[model samples]
Target chain A: MKYFLYGGCSLEAGGKNYMVSLEPVCKALGMEFEEIEDWNCCGASISYAGANELSIMTLNARNIAIAESTGGYDIVAPCSSCYIQLVKTNHELKEDAELRNKINVILKEGNLNFKGSLNVRHLMDVLYNDGGIDKIKSTAVRPLKGLKVAGYVGCQTVRPYGEYDSVERPKVHDLLLKAIGADPVPFPKKMQCCGSGIFLTELDRCLGLVKEILDDAIANGAQLISTVCPMCALNLEMYQDKVNAKFGTNFNMPVVYLTQLMAVAFGMDLKKEAALDYCVIPPEGIIKAAIGG
Target chain B: MAGNYDPSFAKEVFDNVDSGEEIKMCMQCGICAGSCPLRHEMDYPPRQIFTLIRAGRRDEVMNSKAIKLCTSCYRCKVRCPRGIPVIDVMHGLAHYGIKKGIIPRKGTAAFGGEFWKMIYNIGRIDEKTLPLKYNLLEGLVPGIKSTIEMAPMGIQMFLHHRMKLLPERKIKGIKELRKMLDKAKEMGKGGAN
Candidate 1:
């Protein structure tokens, strides 16, 4: 089936290395990616805080309208924030006509209209539901037998309003991790915030918030923390030294984007995949140590 | 250190709190407390904090070190069987206490509080001035050693064009941001006890 690949601002800004790999993987799996034509920022974190309900809803609604206009019901967003915001706006618009009307007025500025006729899904949800774990198992060229991976869902992916998975204890990421043949490490802080949204502004608080989550992953015996969001990956990777210095604790957990790990499990070349270039703590040494590559 | 406190203070805090979830639904199973990393360091663990709040110890609850230690990780809130949103209530109380100067500012420990102020005062965070600002407010040295150590990284970051001195590239929504901050500050101050 043809899907509208909703690569939001993070992807547009070249922040999502995972999305780069995901494009090929999806194509190989017989799924066609039709990018939403000329989509703007979902307003990311700022839109929710800055605008009224209608403005934010309509802004996201415009993108949904574009996808619907293409006759594409499934809009697969690789970015967790984009998926959450688009889905949330869709739900709100569908439930509240007054909100929908108000947002439509704003969309009129750009000569666009939103009828709320699309389903926004995270890449994880689409893969797990449509293709299923069996498809993943069948496609595995190499098995991730020994690697212990902690699946981090983050706040936006599975919470605030629970539509995708269990809000309190999400296992969608874990299911995806296992589907790729990696051992999913069970940790209580899976759905915690990585503090990346406010990291640029609130350095200490962000560091503290991330450190707590990372420590929990390490304590739970996770060798690497795998996440879907680039910000979460960047925060967890780039800020390790800062967190170590601030907390006076040794936490050497490497952060990998979920796609990177999946690619690795799929037997994609480590150097060709460019996983080592993106990692703050190189995965080569760890992978070599783990599997004797 | 203030032992002379009203017993109903915690109750008042609890009563005034809008957890957005039912507090009575808590099973008091200590899963929240057990799972909390800051539990050992807290004077009142998550369970005790709940108990004290339920007991109406408003002043004690507001002024407790327990609230200060919370990283707002939502571990307790997530793990709570009843889904009490304990972190939300704690955040409210912590904000209340900080405004009234009941809780001494413990530098970067109160990073959330300082963040609100920084955003409110300046349109955006000035990355060049952040180290000095953070160090001074946190009672740590904004010393030469730290700067020297950071220099290579900073220079590399600059060379790579990763770091920006001024935050606002084109002053996107600066006026609206100012107005929003003003409104937020007014609301925060007006809501204080």
Candidate 2:
């Protein structure tokens, strides 16, 4: 399938390893991504405080028009926030003609227009739906062989859309985990908020939220948490020390991107393909034990 | 509370805020508050905020940190029995608050201002610069103190190569982007048309 990538700001900076590991995983799955030229920030969840609906929508509308200008290939946003903004734009524009016309008028300033002809997808959705579980399993050279994983879906991936999976009880991430031969533990807080960008502003409150999610995952006996969203991965991985500091909990759990685990299972290099060293809370020891490298 | 009430506040919200009309559907169900991950942090939960809007508690609603503190988790949106897009309304209130020059939460407002300005100016964000700029919003002394507080993480990220020391280049289409954004703001000047 033709796919154009919209790697949001986090993937370019803080979550660079996510994009690194995703490369090999997609290649192994025969998925090719061409980066969308001159794509702007999705405005993310923070846009709500700073911009009105029309402005944020116009920001994403530019991206949609950019993709349409080129073959209109399906846009795959690795970040959950980017996916939501893009999809929200498409959903809103398709439903509201007056809004679409207004946005189109704004787009004319950029010498572009939004036709809403293509699909805006999260990489997790693209992997689970387009690349079937069995296909992923077949390509795995070395399956994980029942390493306990908490498949954290985070918020925006399944919520509000719920097209491919149940919003309340998402299982696609777990299903994908199972395909790689990892045992997905019954993680009740899998869909819980990780506080996203709020971490930077409200440190204490955000840490409280992160603490609960980590506490739940650890309680369920997860060796490591496999996540899809960049913001989720960054928050869950980087804030563990702070959570432990504030909450006085002795917790040291590894947080891995879903693609990183797939990279290991597919028998790819740990340092090169998986980019395991970049992780804040490294999973190398547990990962090595799982695959017996 | 009576001193701060304005009877037309509800209608103003309904007409101006994004998805603000949907607040009318909220039946005072506390499911939104119960579902909120940061309910403790909020001065008034989503349910109470809606009731405040209807009660014409304009200043209380706008000045409360509840609206600006939303994490956008979509938990309330998914679980609401009334199908209220709670996240949107909360964010809409936040945007409306800022537009009216009432900052409910200083830190959130400061960070969001820098974030949006970065995006608007360059069409993309330089993660390293965003926090630095946000810290400096209060002045150089506070900025230095805040930056010092975050120095450890910054150094760690720099070591890990997660943050670039060099300035980020503007996108090729930044001019066009600015034009579109200028027009969007102009059209939205009359408030939520």
Q: Which candidate is the best by lDDT?
A: 2
Predicted candidate 2 versus true structure: per-residue lDDT over A127-202, tens digit per residue: 9988889899998888898799999999998767776789898889999999998999999999888998778999
What value does DockQ give for candidate 1? 0.08
- Per-residue CA lDDT of model 1 for B2-55, tens digit only, reads 345466665455444434135567778988778665566578876776776666
RMSD (CA, angstroms), candidate 2: 1.6
lDDT (10s digit) by residue, model 1, range A243-275: 888989887787777777767666776645524
The number of the candidate with the highest TM-score is 2
Off by over 4 Å in 2: none
Query: Cα deviation of A246 in candidate 1 (Å)?
Result: 1.3
lDDT of each: 0.63, 0.87
Runs of candidate 1 exceeding 4 Å displacement: A12-14, A289-292, B1-193
**DockQ of all models, two decimals each:** 0.08, 0.73
